[model samples]
Target: METNMTLYHGSNIDFEKISLDKAKDKRDFGRGFYTTTIREQAKEWAEILNYRSRRDGCFLYEFTFEKTDNLHIKSFNGITEEWLNFIVENRLKGGVQHSFDVVIGPVANDRTVNTIGLYLSGDYFLDEALRRLEYFKLNDQVSLHTEKALSYLKFIRKYTWTA
Candidate 1:
């Protein structure tokens, strides 16, 4: 990963600030500000959010992230046993599970979430969940879990995308 990277946050509403309080919990990385390195993925998120909110358009906010060694960072190159366990802990137990300021990893899709649910409900084993998750073509998500982490991301611009 580069020291400086471009990230995009997509939502149904335009915002000048990224608030962790406003973010939903039980996410893949717990409650945090999520951004993606892929623009198309961001766009898709915007569209999905817009539709869910019954909004006509969405906003794609761009940011420039300056990574520094001062803060703790956790990265997962792909879905693995460790990643799965970490995700399960965060999703099942709603709160910050780790001390990492930033976490870079694959976003759990709907199927993956369901698989996790099955695993939690005793319908699926750990190996089964991992096997199910393997089928997904995962997308990358960089989650800022702290205010200090948010400080590294500078808002660049915003684009309005219509349906």
Candidate 2:
């Protein structure tokens, strides 16, 4: 129940605007502008993306947003059957699956991606997936899913991780 917090977004390129249209589908939280509460995690993402495309160099954008009762939000504090199913539906369906303006939850990072994949592929059952997921630490992600949600975020600054 954090009301206000700083968030970071790591990207291959720097952009002045945050555009949901450019966001890739089938994401953990569905097509939306994603940020994280962890700075190190965001930096790691920038490094990985930088290694992949080397675009405009690794960039970490900082933003701050305050939670309000006026906006619809979905939050997952930990891995659960509901969280697992939500991710599965979003990944398999390739679009927004809910009406929430923002979603805050545990990210299915590198450690959990394989487990999630196995579950999706039917190689692992729900109970097995949950059991496997417990072995890895999860990161938090804050995704803005609407223009109204996006407006709440105020850009703080941008850090260039690569020269």
Candidate 3:
């Protein structure tokens, strides 16, 4: 499939009321604006977040990567020792500091959440965690990790949730 620069961020709140400043810490790839190439995954995220916020449906916000220049970027092609470590680091309570302005890779979804939790809690080592994650096909995501990267994300449009 042809990848578009356009990406989407889903939330339970309405578009107008959405605020980037309100984002909390201890998130995947740190507290930053996260978008994905897969719309279905965004929908799934919306539905999941909506359940907790008591929002009616998901709000899809579109954005574009404006600066694809010599910007600092990192891409993990697939599940690997390094990829699993990166995800584990970012999701940990203290959080990991990364040099990349943007990081692109698979998401740690519901299926892998517990395994990640196990790894974080010292229940599973790297190899064991990765072995478990390999069972489920992961989805791709792009996360803008710095203000410099976030500045390049230009909002394109908003779509209502009906799916």
Q: What is the C-alpha lDDT of each candidate?
A: 0.89, 0.90, 0.76
What are the root-mean-square deviations of the candidates from the true structure over C-alphas?
1.4, 1.5, 3.1
Ranking by lDDT: 2, 1, 3
Compose the digit string of candidate 3's lDDT tens values, residues 79-146. Answer: 88888877767777434368888888888887888998898889999889888989898888888767
lDDT of 1 by residue, 1-163 (tens): 4499899998898888888899888878888988999999999999999999899998999999998897799999898888988898898788788889999999988767888889889999888888888889899999999999998999999999688
Best candidate according to lDDT: 2
Ten-residue segment with the worst summed lDDT in candidate 1?
A: 108-117
Per-candidate TM-scores read 0.94, 0.94, 0.84
Clashing pairs in 3: none
lDDT of each residue in 1-163, candidate 2, tens digit only: 4488899999887799999999989999898999999998898888898888856588999998988887999999899999999998898898899999999999998778889999989999999999999778888999999999998899999999564
Lowest lDDT 10-residue stretch of candidate 3: 15-24
Residue 105 in model 2: lDDT = 95
lDDT at 66, model 2:
83
The Cα error of candidate 2 at residue 6, in Å, is 0.6
Candidate 2: worst 10 consecutive residues by lDDT? Answer: 47-56
